[model samples]
Target: MTDHAQEQEMEIEALEAILMDDFKEIDPSESGVSTTNRCFQITLSPQEDDLDASNYTPVQLALIFSHTEKYPDEPPLLNVKSIRGIKTDDLNMLQEKLEGEAYESLGMSMIYTLATSAKEWLHEKYGQNVLDEVVEEPASTKDDIIIPHGEPVTTETFLAWRERFEAELALERAKLMPESALTAPKDKRLTGRQWFESGRAAAKGPTTVPEDSEEEEEIDFDDDFEDDDDEMLEHYLAQKSEKSAEESKN
Candidate 1:
């Protein structure tokens, strides 16, 4: 194969490795085939070629590989687009801050974070309260916005936090379920108004016999045979004596 073709092949392999690594943290199977394709598209971008503190975030750098032509050594043309969320002013500030840095080669996510510490600067300069408020109503534009819309933030950085947030929400739902279930009336497995409705239904239900009904069915005992008992005993004694005499003779 030509050197250019060989270079493209290597870039593809590297990009695939990054995506596979992501699969470790997230279930690609659950996400769908499109997710892998999307990841590939990002990984093959020209922005990846210029990955550095000056050029892109870790996510942006990872995406560059997939954007390159199959023959990479012919000089890949970058149609690099930033992800949404970063504001336009923020992008200017980021570029100014990253002036001296140049991406020699790509590295892991942490390297990107370290290289682009612009977020940290923004927080420190603007204060936590202001930054938090601005982040909520993220700027929506394509004017090469730096922080929010310039490029999508790496999922490695944000997805983990999002998953934890989701888990906490699920836990909160679970916590409420038992309380509702326990307070629920026998006729229904819900609570509050439903419980009240269930209680009404139970009140209208069929009347069952009392658990002690067997005891109520029992009859009282009496000694009515006592008067004839003595006479019977005397007769039995006389018969017993006659039988004894006959046995003695035999």
Candidate 2:
């Protein structure tokens, strides 16, 4: 193979490995780099906390990368496709920013750089504060619907809120229950006694306490021990009183 062809193959392999490691999925039809041509598409998802708790719809975007024959020496063409929840102007701005980034990375592997830039742009444009941009009007008919904090109240919003609340509540309840209780049939709710019984039955391991240790023996609160304790307490009190008296006098 020619030196340029080998270089192209090596670069393609490195790019493929980067994509596989970074993204959960990539379509081969949309991603490839060869001696003659190079093109790839990557889908970027918004962060988990990007949407308002009530907003069920998530924002996603497909970034298509097109490279010239002189790629790695020249910048790649970046196009935004399948965009959701962002304005056209915003997307244009993102494209401009990415183009600038590619130009800045003149002679380096630019695929990972482009992908990282796209993700950061998505977070900035459509993350947790997305609702602030959506509900621009001062008032609307949808205002009457009560929603959870950081979420707009709609049918989907209410459902998402309920799901989140239930998940958090279940976690709290699990904290109070024994580990053995978690193994019980989820559909069957066990009473307090039943929970105790299940836990007791599951605990078949040897006892942690020593069989006949002196520490476990009953203590004798006899007069001699009590007298000694009282004397020590009196001595401590006397010393404390003397310290206080000296400080007050000073």
Name the best candidate (by lDDT): 2
Q: Tens digit of lDDT per residue, candidate 1, span 23-128?
A: 1222334322333321232321112223342333222222121223332323232112234334557545555453323232322112223233533554354433
Give candidate 1's total backbone clashes.
21
- Model 2: per-residue lDDT, tens digit, 130-197? 54445555665645866467655577878988999978765654555555567778777664434433
Model 1 lDDT at residue 206: 57
Off by over 4 Å in 1: 21-40, 43-74, 88-250
Error of 2 at 24 (Å): 10
Scored by Cα lDDT, where does model 2 land? 0.62
Local distance difference test scores for all models: 0.40, 0.62
Model 1: lDDT of residue 51? 30
TM-scores for all candidates: the values are 0.22, 0.41
